[model samples]
Target chain A: MALADARAICPDLATRPADLVREATTLAALRRWAGRYSPMVARDGPDGLMADITGVAHLFGGEAELRADLHARLARAGMAAQSAVAGTFGGAHALARHGGGIIPDGALADRLGPLPVAALRIDHDTAEALGRLGLRRIGDLIPRARAPLARRFGPGLVGRLDQALGYRPEPVAPEAEPPHFGVRLSLPDPVGLQSDVMAGLARLLERLCEKLGRHHAGARRLRLELDRVDHAGVQVEIGLAGAMRDPARIAALFEKGVEEVDAGFGIEAMRLVATVTEPLAPAQIGPARAAPQDGMDDLITRLGNRLGFETIQRLAPAESLIPERSFQVLAAAWSRAAPADRPGGPPRPVMIFPPEPVMAAPGHPPARFRWRRMALTTLRATGPERIAPEWWLDDPAWRSGLRDYWRIETREGPRLWLFHTPQAPAWSAQGVFA
Target chain B: MRCERAGSGALQLAPTRVHEAEGFGRHAFALFQSVCHDGPVVWVGPAHAPERLLLAGLPQGVGERLHIVRAGGVDLLWAVEEALRAAPVGLVVAELETALSLTAGRRLQLAAEAGGTTGLVLIRQGAGSNAAQTRWHCAPRPGAGADSTLHQWSLIKNKRGTLGDWTLHWDGTSAAFHLVAETGERRGPAPPPL
Candidate 1:
């Protein structure tokens, strides 16, 4: 409806532009607060709340008592809220908006039949169409054959009807809160020295590790935030290849990072947070199995902290016929070290890249060619190893068609892997066997 | 040049020492040395020369225990030193396109000594000297037959053993190096001009 029409209908109406993002944020905060009622509270549309209070309603004496307490609390918080309790989420959603009440298990259909067709959660168009057909009430459509209603309005109409009548399951999925693991320390006397910062960091780590120990979790990534007296502050973040919780080892890892953080006038506060964590089982010093942890993991973690973890990789074989797709590069931090199965078949070049164009005169294998600004004479040629592209995969690089690979030994001291695409009629160098 | 088959004793790159190889086949020789050890191998590739080995082309044993590390220009040496110091690995191979200082080389050597790991540095360009235990210059010998490829290796500087040169043949099928003898005109101080 236009604003002018709404104002003509009710000249005293209040109006404000809708801020959807802010509204969503406020609703999300409200949902978090509603967690006090039940762990399974979920947002019911934009203005209502759906809470599965099956076993929890007894704690508040009864469903009516719980609703009274909720209404009292919401009123005290200066927000008007409407809520409905039913056996089904659809039933609850519809009733909360149309008529508020509690419908027992078997009485759901009896209570929902009196509501308008719009209460079935169908769109306004479907409701208006149902009204034209004299099926304005949910009870009016309940007795009709489902196939006709489905054929007339599409499957969504029947699906929503079934969901509302408890014939279909409509479970409420609540959003979970993220875990928080952080510790902070405020200094009485501002200190700027690196040693002083290290001391403060150690204290924060001690408390943070205790918290992690209780949860049987270990930090995989951590950040240290320093609040300077005069400057904005600085943050040092480090990612470990594996989970760790030891204070000494963690402190050692932060040595370089702490040294680089400038302490502007002086340090006022320090906070250390584990932004990422993983489950880690406690280890007992057992006989024979107590050989010190593998040094490779430590090495990887230490290096990963400085040079991003993704930069360290291992090669693993992938089942593919394409030359470039034959091997997979996996992050060494997360991937288990597996022995590579020696690739079978013809010899492959030691190094390979995307085929770079080469200047060559017409020939099966060019007798002489220019590549990378170097003119070289071909001493001999070895192969016409034909490799066809995988038909199922539409790779842009392989669109050049059937490739005839050749091992050409140049007059200079280098062997190059050159290919000729028959379909495209061009020659390119893809690799070198150094 | 006339070359004879080297003596029976294999080329021994002692563990816990830094060895340098330069020239065309430097990377290949470094990989060859890496597989000889027992544990993991870390290949530190500098950003400037981002050369990588085709896994499918590598020999069966080469890919199983290899970990490739890509580091920036300045971090290249630092990563190598860190890998050397953490020495549980069998070998650390660093490809150096930029010049390496004597101090950096000595630090790498000390780290290798402390960790008991062998360090092989593949000098791609420049002819800078370092405190490496041995320095090798290698190149491919042209006209190698269809079945086998030849790489000429000259040990220019050997701190522990005598300096020498040899030609080794790489058999495609077996994936092993065999010392071969070459008979040709000598180039260094051999025959007087007629």
Candidate 2:
């Protein structure tokens, strides 16, 4: 517990401060190396390793041979490891700490029946309580009634025994490895030129595309990371509408962003990662479709990076008679739905703004009105098209009751779309027919 | 403001120093309507700029052919350059502060050559030695309250090395431009006045 008390027993004992972060990093690295044995490898508690080798045992000759190889490799890496294989997770865990080997199917109960009940992984209080009941070995609790045993010792005691005896399923969840479509390049000497950065980025893209080709994948979001010697790293990202792999097009899209990167001192290395990817099927480029698809994808990608991915939006019509509710904005890259054209109705305004009140001369269609900042003189008036609020819908903007829309051409040579609400003694400019 | 398929390239139009009042975006839509091609035109300006009203003074179909991109005030130039390189659209109208370096102008010219996209930079401030084929200083002469559009334009820089100045008028109902010669010599529908 305390270093001072331990040193009192042996005055010359040595000690060092614990580095938990470093230990955790080393464990994670060990987990990656263990993936060579099987894809499903997990860290068991703080010091153990768990690898699932179901149908993969044949790849390394057999289960015992794979375990031997793993132990030898770990020993060479300065780590002493212990492992076991069994039909159940609890059986393997218990046997690995007590007696290590491959236990055949349906033989876990017989092999583990003689071990102490402590090997069931119960705590000290439960073990002492079990000892008070004169149950010293795992076999001592096997022939007892389950309901009575559960009532006295609790369900956890019974559950652990069932799991160790292969009666319950306790599947081990392995720590998953990070999925990355990334490539890196390190220069012999640090270079700060944009052309050099471009060259390194081009190399990284080639390697990344090769890896993507092997996996039949395409990147939707790419990250360019440039690490400078002065410890300042610049990262830029580009998004695409569809899957892309063309190196020239991808590099061209990053031109503006790359120029803005501040390579303080010099950049030593560059990394390109396809952070977001999707499965792309191999398809033959038919004559009519290839050119249009490529061109469209290029255009959308450039616009998305230049402005913003969210700023480029497509308008889709909705099933509503209300002016504002008649359309919705969808992301241009994500939407394929086009607005359906409605015929035989007056054209909607090209632009709509917040209602700016204008003083209307009290008459059936005011001849001239003052819109606060400017006095608009009406040259012609066309409509009394009435739009009523949807009663079933609770909209805050529609609380003004009802509106009558009119298309008028002002004497100032501008076409205007104006609306009048019966509740207020004024008219408001809604849209422009410009 | 009309499209010319000849030795001409992308032209940069800026309002003179005396006419900088609301000049950056005041006439962007006007110049855009005069020379736009068949494809959509991208209008790049500050985030605070009133972009929706830029189409109010143009014809009916011109409003539908526009795609607006809101950029940060400083990144407006880069956005315009990127749009030009995309080559899908024919015209790129960018409203930005006029503080461009010579290299920035040359880069825009090179990008336009690669994509064949026309670049129109609308700025309130003036600069010297432009890479644009033609530089025009524009000031609007509204017809009091009528639709008879009159604009005085000075040709500051011409690629062929010739310079001139003129005033042009447009018929609103007919959507046609008429050159108003100083000595009453030129007449009829004028060339585009972008």
Best by lDDT: 1
- For model 2, residues A387-434, the per-residue Cα lDDT tens digits are 999999999877887999987766654456788888754578877552
TM-score of 2: 0.59
Candidate 1 residue spans exceeding 4 A from truth = A1-79, A83-179, A230-233, A284-294, A356-363, A367-380, A390-400, A410-413, A424-426, B1-9, B48-50, B142-145, B171-176, B181-194
Candidate with best TM-score: 1
| Residues B75-148, model 1: lDDT tens digits | 88888988888857888999887777899889999999998888999885555456889898977766557734
Residue A109's lDDT within candidate 2 is 78
Looking at model 2, residue A47 earns an lDDT score of 63
lDDT of 2 at A121: 81
DockQ (0 to 1) for model 1: 0.54
**DockQ, 0 to 1 scale, candidate 2:** 0.10
Tell me the tens digit of each residue's lDDT in model 2 across B25-111. 235334433343545566666666433442333343444445556667556777777767765665666666665567877787777
